[model samples]
Target: MEIDEKDERIDKIDQILNDEIDIDVNQEGEEAEFSSLQDKYQINSGEALNSSDIYRIAAKESTRMIVLVGPVASGKTTMETSLYQLFQNSPVNDFCFAGSYSLQGFEQRAFYTRIKSKGNEPTTQRTSLEDNQAFLHIRLWNRNNNVISNLILADISGEAFTNHIGQVDEAKISFPFIERADYVVGIIDGEKLCNKKTRNSIVSEMIEMIRTFWDAELITDGCVLQIVFSKFDLFSKVENHNLILEKIKQQIVARLSELFMDIEYYNVAAMPSTIDEFSVGYGLEDLLQGWVRKHVRKSSRKMEEPFDELTEYDRLYYKFLGELNE
Candidate 1:
């Protein structure tokens, strides 16, 4: 009876989720420009997607963007690299690999952090803010609905986030991308979660970041915020996972619960534990699954109004301000 009840609940949730999200899966792969990159290495067409490229993509009928926001060394790039590797090497349970406009972009970023790299020592270089508008694009074919979804992921600099936390205008000046994001992936270093001092600072920074978003009017009632505790493997070695998690919920979530209409949390390692290489990417699959569900659901629903894009005037104004600073 218990098993039956559990199954029933799962079915109900699936039904509700499907109703809320309109995702149509691709029945068969199409022969198009995207097909050429199936070889992964013989990339004839690919380039780093800049702000204009992403803006053009988003301007299309159904394109969704997921922006990563966190401090440096918070595993934003690691998570991204891991996701691409997973999609490339192996297919997620139900989702099939479609094609990416930025295949070479994914390969370039994912190359350094490849799990099979020499020495097996985790080596992830700090993501340099080369281009503020640049992003890695991943397109997936959702098996559930057979819908093709374009996903835009960004690795914004920690310094950029730090600069704008308490200051709205500063955030506006630095983070024009935030205003156009559909989801904000807030990454917290798991090692910090184990330390009381760092934990306190993390929550404060998170609160301030949210406040900046609120002040800028970047957050809408429908916008989703997903907080990921990265490097969970590190935390497990020193502290009780449940205890630290509960403390974060009590301290961080409790304080900022009212700000977001929808929120979720996950603990991911993104790589194998230092102790052993047996279990790699502990909670990444769950994170990606949740992300897929949210993406598809939002894509299916028609918005009451379209979102505003960053205009030429805004760009010219920022450029002018930069010249004045120089």
Candidate 2:
């Protein structure tokens, strides 16, 4: 009886969502198709950091695409906002902020967190799942190398990652940028990792996520995988902090060591707690410096080409066939 009731409720919700979508399509035009949903709902659409502009920038210079993956409330937004604010105001190590294509978009995400309430501490609003296509763009100028590089950081809602956690094929479909990403940042909530009850779930989800990436070939041997423990300020206060960190390494990192070649770990306190509002973004600069170094030094993921496997005779045959077809 409970299962039936649950199914009925799901059916009702599905119907309502379909109805709303139909209404939206009808209101727009008959020419509007279901495939256009991204354009209609994606936050990047008609914004400064839209896909078209980012692609154009990529064509001109090599842009390091880093995708952030984590569960809901894993501090993805907070890290992004804090990083943006830091880049805007301060110089990270030696790299100076050259410019950004999406300054206004950065402001939109960072503004709310900067606001302070009289009685209550300000919280960063959850990044909506609807805005999957949006990315925060940061460009840095290296004084030592005299090279300018752009960092395209993708922030998909944590719910998206969790929803497709174990679904390997579905994860490939959902996270299309994984194929082109230079680095994958697996953001885990440090506070949750410290809690005994939640630790298992977090570790399980991360393991599954890594499996999905490996199975889908989105992450290969050479690709860099970064495991970040966010909200470390809270986690550090716990008495069993060392034990929790060891567990994470043993359970999560040790288990997946075979799948990736270069795996790095970092702990970050991205935001200030109510008690230490003045010390905002403690331990975040190190993370940013590491990220920037990767962006500057890491090579792009090499795509496997079929021609590499072809024999000399087969190559000639294909060339002849191509000429005939032409």
Candidate 3:
């Protein structure tokens, strides 16, 4: 039998794999050893990523960074897990769930809401202050355009924001990601908004937090801000919900309009207490659509930077391939 060019290449590759790589295919438990090697290199996914992991992803392709800002127990984690859970049933908006690097992270937070936990009401696990800076990643495929968007949602603890209230210098140092963020979501607890005593204070504190970021230069006038009122089911229980919501919106606009040119509001009952009355992941479709719209608009005017100085891998992955695709 004559060896063709393709066969010659395959044989050479096999020779390199067996000889140069020194793979003992005939050795006992070779499969087990290969699995061990994979584990040794930490090749598995499903864990929340850190800053270094995010950098690696960004270097490969463009990613949208979304930072959720709020006080503790304000539904930030719930909102994140709810978005992930939404894809479990069907596509969100027009985006389909392609995959996730942090499936374990999402499931861990959503465990309490599952029937296996046997809880009377769905409750989200509060994000710990220690893991406040972790990023939960999801890759969504757009049905209409056949485009893939990599979204990294920062699960920042509410304590992180509250502790740095009025502390601009500290906030600047702590939240460097805010400068690169595509969206900064400020979560307002709807239950607190319904309370007359806490309503004014919550509104004032939220404004002050934004001001601190503005003074620190972490959030610029160009930054897109999403004001999210979570647990709307509880807030809507109040008789004058519309009036109160209007007042809150007016207050936010009056305080933040000068600092943020793009400010959008969303009322979501993520994991609502009254599941029958309100659907799970309520109002999140609009939020997802808004993110896609803003991202498209931003990408149009954004300039591509030179990757000549970057590593060969980064250049190959991002510069060459990314530009060619564009």
Candidate 4:
């Protein structure tokens, strides 16, 4: 009965999520491009989708603008890299534009990467991201068939988030392509969750920024927010997985629920830096893992581990975020 009920829920989810978002169909190169992709990647049967299928569908039909928002060193870039790969390695083709930039005097940077099936990879060589003057730029097409394209993962520095109130006006400044986003990726720092005062502070600030953005009308789609609790490597090494998941969710439900009328949250951990291999974890019920340790006052801790469970977590995170609209 449990399995049956779960299956029923999944079906309802599928029905609500099968169609692409109601985008501005009139935008130049938008409808024609998506229509071209739909022609090639349309699903025909009731068979459930595999990871590859999810990647393919997202690659072809995803014409949405995405932005990554989180604390400094919260692994936004890593998540972005993995998500790009999750789509790229899938049987479905996805395209990405690596050209990213930043405005001077502003601590933040802007990048434009199109998320679509493999269409064509950018040919030009790009400069390193650390070179404040240079941006990590490339325009890639990862689709061989129909192609769906939209900008991905571009933003300013953590200071853009840190110096919020003092620089709130500058925060409103065009930091990146986020001024009009269809998707907002919020990466949460796990170790921070263990700390009570810090956790609440972190959550409050994020909620405020999001509220500020929404009220300001800078976003094209405030409907979806993909809240990712990244750096699970340190989290599991310190506490029990089940307990951690529940607490994490509760924190999110308490703090972030106000940001959106509908929301989806995911606890994600990337490959442990200690491990030479790559992995991911997803779908754990968030339980408060434990009280913050007396020794670790730092918000983020780098821990070593023998790992398993970290691949496909963040993308599945995206899959569920899409569920919010349902």
Q: Among these predicted structures, which one has the highest TM-score?
A: 3
Between candidates 1 and 4, the lDDT winner: 1
* lDDT, candidate 3, 160-240, per-residue tens: 899999998999888888887888899899999888999999888888888898889887435688999999999989998
Residue 132's C-alpha lDDT in candidate 1?
Answer: 46
The lowest-lDDT stretch of 10 consecutive residues in candidate 3 is 294-303
In model 1, the runs with Cα more than 4 Å from the true position are 1-45, 115-120, 275-278, 294-326
The total of clashing pairs for model 1 equals 7
TM-scores of all candidate predictions against the true structure: 0.71, 0.72, 0.77, 0.47
lDDT by residue (94-169, candidate 1, tens digit) is: 7777877778766766666655666456656566665643588877887878787777887677767777778887
lDDT for model 2 comes to: 0.72
Q: Mind giving the per-residue lDDT tens digits that candidate 2 earns over 1-326? A: 99998887567557656764333544444224543764556553333364556687789886887788888889887888788787767777777888787777777766667554332554566777887447778888888888788888887778888888668888777766677777788887888977878978887787788778778777744467888888888788889787778877887656777666567788888786744633667767776666666432322233233776767786665555342221
Q: Lowest summed lDDT over 10 consecutive residues: which window, candidate 4? A: 287-296
Error of 3 at 52 (Å): 1.0
